[model samples]
Target: MIAKAYLWYGVYIILNVLTIAGSDPSGGAGIQADLKTFSALGVYGATAITALTAQNTQGVTALYPVADYIVAAQLDAVFRDLRIDAVKIGMLANVENVLAVSSVIERYKPAHVVLDTVICSSNGYLLLEPCALAALRDRLLPLASIITPNLHEASVLLGEPVAADEVQMIYQGDALRALGAQAVLIKGGHLLGNCSPDWLIEKSGHTRISSVRLKVIGTHGTGCTLSAAIAALRPQNRDWTNAVNNAKIYINQALLQSTRLSVGLGTGPLHHFHAWW
Candidate 1:
């Protein structure tokens, strides 16, 4: 009876999420951003690091990918112990790491998976190799519940030019859906406009989410934050549109709050914990 009671208590404690990505020393992106966003949104976060990056707000200086076996071991440890409700995947530095992540996803099949196709840094540093990108497209896209890609990353994935306007963004979203993701969110923050709009394309239909683009320098981790927020929200909401909408609201507030503080020299990071303080 006591054991059953303990199990019930554990079930109600907190929704657990696992983030498989790289480590950013600056804490603005990668696993750091995912964990922060998950915690802020009331989810318990676990991590399995694919790489370690020496970087700051300005850019990534160097990257050291963890061995494939090590990445697999971390994922195994998390899955064997935690009842993970969601997953968020970020920068995979190489093909081996991508395969490692793919293997675990197939094995565990977490309920919600948000893949932030992090191929490059905000400052134009390459995070994933060409082979890694191919691997991700082939192995991981079909598994993700939703994929959040900025204008540039979407362009890369679709093998075309940048999405110059909303029409093109929608086209790209559909194209990405054709690639196998359950839903595609093409972020328009890089577009030239007063409002940043994201196109969410699902088989049911498509919708646009637009927010006033905050003219702020602290926008380093926006993609990671958005995707992580979606992953954290999915378990409760169980609706992709609501999950994405809530994430956008959270990110907008975080960006607004971050503008007041000075964190780094270059493109700064969002105040991920703004709600708490």
Candidate 2:
């Protein structure tokens, strides 16, 4: 459990989790969103930044991928000290970083690994290179405890179109699971209507996790926020179902209260601090 108690003070047994992702100066997504989720959920958060992006509430302008050695060094530095309870991986900008991260993760073997299968930005900026897609599928999928992919991302992974309905979503999820992910969360937010459903498919069975889809004008960081919430809440919950449910509850409330935030022009970020203000 996170922050419940550690074998040592400020060390193993404590609630220390690392987020290996890119840096979003927009403060709506990437490492910024992940850290907010961790802090809001009362978990200790660390970082191993993969890239730096110039993005706002509107879209991405430029991206600079961090060196592979630096990425590995950051992971090593964090893992060498903290007793990481879980790891939330978001945008890996290239193939080299993917291999580097997977190699280190394969060695340390954190208890919980939540992989956010980020492919492209909502505004059409390619976050992960097309060349890196194979590395992600071959190396990262097998290691992730649960992989979170939106409908479009699922389609990209399977080389098919976006899942149109629940039946298709389930089929796609099962296929992705068969590819090696222990569990697959196919986010159905793109399906439209009042109920925004996400399917949690495991080897034993699958279950639906849905939230009221609010008629919001802007939602730039839903994927980053949701997946980060899962990583933050996983160690605290007894099972994966409870963890995902709690995360859903959090992101739903954040979306419902997003109007309170006047952040950007096109799509505003979720109200990550909804419970407080």
lDDT of 1 at 84: 88
Candidate 1 residues lying further than 4 Å off, grouped into runs, are: 1-11
The TM-score values for the models, in the order shown, are 0.95, 0.95
Stretches of model 2 off by over 4 angstroms after superposition: 1-14
User: Please, what is the whole-model Cα lDDT of each candidate in the order they appear?
Assistant: 0.88, 0.90
Q: Write the per-residue lDDT of candidate 1 for residues 75-182, one digit (tens) a residue.
A: 999999998888999988999999989999999899889999999987778999987888899898999999999999998987899989999999999999999999
Give the winner by lDDT: 2
Clashes of 1: 0
* Model 2 per-residue lDDT tens digits across residues 18-112: 99999989899999998988887778899999999999998999999999999999999999998798999999999999999999999999999
For model 2, what is the error of residue 269's alpha carbon versus the real structure, in angstroms, after optimal superposition?
0.9
Q: What is the alpha-carbon lDDT for the whole of candidate 1?
A: 0.88
